[model samples]
Target: MVTDQAGHPLFTTSRDRVHAEGLWHETFHCFVVNREQRIVLLQERATGKKDFPNCLDITAAGHLLAGETVADGVRELEEELGLVRTLDQLEHVGVFLEELTLPGFVDRERTQVFLTESNQAISDYHLQATEVKRLVAFSFDAFATLGDETTTEVVSIEGERFGRNRFVPHPPEYWAMVERSIGQSSM
Candidate 1:
């Protein structure tokens, strides 16, 4: 489904057309964090993915099809990460507008972002092979450091260090918003 700049429905079109034309569409992004441990979970996109393949991204995310309500987007969690959760089980952060342009593809999205708190081990996640390659853990403190301009790398819980290039590359403002939200989230 395509929509206006504000996410109000306008018309329906194929997914390829939506990205090809840079038509604004709705999407859901869920970040799962373990508040007590100050850790966050991120997923590695499968190498075969059309966009941003092999990059780390939100714990779970997907496009919201035509006629689906925002609440229904929670299904992405179960579909992508095998985590079943209800709308009430997550915190709706806010709707954000994201625009990314490549040589041949453009993506304009009204993304509904949510935060889910969980302490489940990485082994507990059953990843959808085609969408997610693997799950990784990062310390919230280290992630928050990314908000600083000079902070160049963050080490994952497993001891591997990575820079922003490892991520899907959201704008710095988006990362700032995520850092602020994580700081305010309660157990």
Candidate 2:
């Protein structure tokens, strides 16, 4: 079942149908930052993804399957990045409504945003090859600038050079909200 603007259940529908019809559904977005709060993790989407293939995206995010609550969606972090974390370890940022219309898809998601701090090294992550390519960290400042298209800072991922174009095109406000959330949580 999908939800309305107030997050009330609207009706039952298949996931594919919901996307094709622009129905708002629930999703979970988690950002894993370093303990010192200097950087945030980004995951390169695997080339096989149907949408935004090979683009750098949130540390971990996924849709909530039918009947799944937001807390249950936390499993996506461990499933995609091998980072096991409990709900109590995550600080809820806020809910966001994201709307994007691609060539043949209309994605309207009500996202539950969360943040967690970790000092885990990239080498320790066991990536799910089909969903994530690799993980990289960007300084909070650099990421904010990139999101706003203020600078084309070169970022190295596994020895390969990448720039703003390689990252997903989230609105500047989204980046700002993320930064603010991180700041508030660690205070």
Give the best candidate by lDDT: 1
After superposition, candidate 1 runs with Cα above 4 Å error = none
Candidate 2 stretches greater than 4 Å from native: 149-161
Candidate 2 — what's its lDDT? 0.83
TM-score each candidate.
Answer: 0.95, 0.90
C-alpha lDDT score of every prediction, in listed order: 0.89, 0.83
Q: Write the per-residue lDDT of candidate 2 for residues 10-55, one digit (tens) a residue.
A: 7788878988989999999999988574888889999999788999
Tell me the alpha-carbon RMSD of every candidate. 1.2, 2.1
Error of 2 at 15 (Å): 2.5
RMSD of 2: 2.1
